[model samples]
Target chain A: MVDLDVEEPNSGLFVKGKLEETNPVYKMVPVWEKDKCTFCGNCQKVCNFNAVIQLHTQVLVFPKLCHSCYACSELCPTDALPMKPEKIGEIKTFHQDNLTFLESCLNIGQEMAVQVIAHTNKILEKDYQGQLIIIDAPPGTSCPVIEAVKDTDFVLLAAEPTPFGLHDLKLAVDTMRKLKKDFAVIINRFGLGNDKIWEYCQRQNIEILAKIPNSRTAAELYSHGKLIYKQIPQVKQEVLKIANKIRQLSGEPK
Target chain B: MRIAFTSQGSTWNDPIDPRFGRAPYLLIYDEETDKLEVIDNTAINQVAHGAGPETARKLFQAKPKVLITGNGPGGNAARVLENANITIYIGAGSLTVEQAYKKYKNNELKNY
Candidate 1:
């Protein structure tokens, strides 16, 4: 399983593994040479994000504000600005029995998760292929989620059986539809909230793959950092059923 | 000096639009000639992002000394306008474009 939730990846908690390797991820940002700069304010004028500013004698570059579009360097008449790599995050690899888990951890106060996520995928592309890769994506239909789900074979959307769940589920559905990816819905904490999600799924012709019923035991196991599927046979069976369905849909032999 | 007012319509009596970036029309009032010219803002409807900055850029090209609007030239737009040495004035809500212009000439509106 690859955990692409660079902002807050927690899948490492579920598996007992040996820390194998770690590597830092870096992104390019413009570095200005003051002596070469003429204070023309051309860089400032061209920057859409206000990342560059010129004040009388000096040019200021805000590294965090920069999107690293290379526009400033490309447009600079004096060739004063040069690109430099700045460390944004780290990728860690863990080894457990037969499964290899890769997780990307973004540095605190960093706003660029997309860079880290893309780097993680690059590592995955180089090292692994033709395996059961389950990506634990960040919860949202935003940029980060798009980065995680892009180029994937199928998407499994997990939601609760409530009004807010339906609202967000609708958003996720819209995103998946726009991306034109094959996807199914899974209701987490089922039998507790109302059946609006089920109704909406039925109305939209979205397949309901599995329902993990709401239970105090599952909650307790999670609180103790234990896998509920490992402790409860029924939960394990439910997970197995979901796995079988995925295998069937993907046309992979189990 | 030329001044720009955010207007819902092109006429002199048109209501001052509360929105700066998405305003329907920009009335460029020339103080010297006492003539008002309308520039339709809705022409650039295909912008995916940076509508405020794009509009500000267009206004900057018009060489307006001052921009009189109801609410905002948001952070991005404000930066571009400031860079171009154009001053922004606010508090023209529920007033006509002509009324906003008159208030500005009389130094009644608050400068942002």
Candidate 2:
């Protein structure tokens, strides 16, 4: 029931020269008490991610294995476990020229990305004053991705034109269908390999949101951690066009 | 506390038949009397999905403080039982309710 209303600027959710901020959303994780811990290994046993482990003398926890399910804390017999406050991560608002960028960093060894993504979602779900929010999601259809899509206006799935890309994209598509989230495809690296991606999208009736050609310049710029601005203006322009198309699909004005 | 082993029959009135659903009887172990009474989940026969959450709730509500069952409650149902602080013995399998209760009393059932 915590209120998540924060503003993130630009992020391409708004038109050029428009100012914005994402709403603030808070995400929390559970903390454990070691005193009453009997090293019973219950948490380790139930955790699907191997996030918890028990050694000869003590139980060990890997934050990455934690899905933040709270099953362990709830099932603890000795009242030795408690929910501790944890900030999984957060997104920062950045502007790369006319494009607003949402730079999100998951805290090192953080277990739950969903919480942080949900917090980010709070901003996107709120009043945008007629702007488009482009979400660059972490790959995978698990809890993290699911949580990211919650409250999204629309999902523009970015996939490369490759066999592995097709495989993962199908899984992502299935997840979107299961979640009933409306989504479109932005097939990057067009003209690289096969037409299987196009055929699959056609079979599924998924709209082609946009296509980015397999450009070496774009790839090089990305590899160097440089923004699209560092690359040729056309590359930035193509991404902006994709952003505009996303805005149109989202039914947002200008 | 007499705990009932419920698998086949609820009451001792009928033969101890190891049957599915209806055959399952409740093992009521009365610690005070030191006598174990096996009854039917018959009291809850009218209820749908017998041996499910509703029955699990009723079993725990009888104030046994612990239950040894072939299966464990899932989702929020499990959470409810755990919140009530009921010690659950999952994987009771074919073990008679009586045998399971004895095992619990002897502290032989390992906790997860």
Candidate 3:
């Protein structure tokens, strides 16, 4: 499983593995050179981020504010603004038996997550042509989620049955439709909320692959960082049902 | 000396907008000229990011010596104004544009 939730990646905690490899990822930011600068004010004008400011004495560059668009560097008249790589995040690989979990994490205080997620997608998954890859996408159908699910063959949306859940689920479904991607839904904490979710899904013709029941035992096990399927029969059955549906979708019928 | 304020409306009696980045109007009071200039700032709200900084960029172009807003501009906006040698006085959220100016004169506002 590749966890693309770069902001707060804790998917690896569910799986036991030894750390295999770690790689740092960087994004480019403009650095100002004092001597090379001609006080042209070109860099400041070109920067949409307001990251580069030209004062009377010297030029100022705010590293955190830069979006790494390279506009200032490319447009600088005197080559005062040059692009430099700044570490933004890291990718870590863990191995246990036949499972390889790739976890990518964005460094704290970083503004962007697309680079880290895109980099994570490029590594390892390319060579696994026939293997089953389960991706954990970031919450919300925004830019980060777009970067995570854009390349996937299928998207499985996990949502609770609350009013908030129905709202977000509708958004995700709309986003998937807009992206022209085939997707399914899995309603979690199924019994906890009203039947509005069901009514909405039925009206929309959205196929629900599985419904994971809300159980005290499952919640307890999950809180303890233990896989609920191992101890709870009801949860295990639902997981198996979802796996079978996935197999049928993959055309690997058992 | 000229002072800038984020205002809800174009008039001096309008309440000051605490949010500098997405304020409806930017009001500049030119003490030297005994005049007030109000610029529409609704355009920058449409920007995807850097609203604070972009607003600051526009605010700096007017060359205000000091900024009086409800709450101050955020870090990104603050940096740009600071670099431009503009002083920021905040905690004017409850006051009108004219009242905020009075507070500024009386030194009742907190300098941010």
Ranking by DockQ: 3, 1, 2
Q: What would the per-residue lDDT of candidate 3 be over residues B1-112, giving only the tens digit for each residue?
A: 9999999999899999999889989999999898999989988767777778778878878889999998788888888788888999999998999999999999999999
Residue A136 displacement (Å), model 1: 0.5
Q: What TM-score goes with each of the models?
A: 0.70, 0.51, 0.93
Worst 10 residues of 1 chain A by lDDT: A53-62
Per-prediction tally of clashes: 0, 44, 0
Best by TM-score: 3
lDDT per residue (tens digit) for residues A1-254 in model 1: 89999999999888789999999999899999998898888987888765676645666666666778999999999989999999999999999999999989899988788889988888777778777788999998998999899968899999999889989999999999999999999999988889999999999999998888899999999988898988888788779888998788668887
Interface root-mean-square deviation, candidate 3 = 2.2
Q: Write down the C-alpha DockQ for each prediction.
A: 0.07, 0.02, 0.46
The clash tally of candidate 2 reads 44
Residue lDDT tens for model 1, B1-112: 9999988999889999988877878889999998898888886566545567667767877888999999868776777678878889999978998899889989999999
DockQ of 1: 0.07
Docking level for model 2: incorrect
Model 2 Cα displacement at A135 (Å)?
A: 1.2
Sorted on lDDT, best first, the list reads 3, 1, 2
Summing lDDT over every window of 10 consecutive residues in candidate 2 chain B, give the lowest-scoring window: B12-21
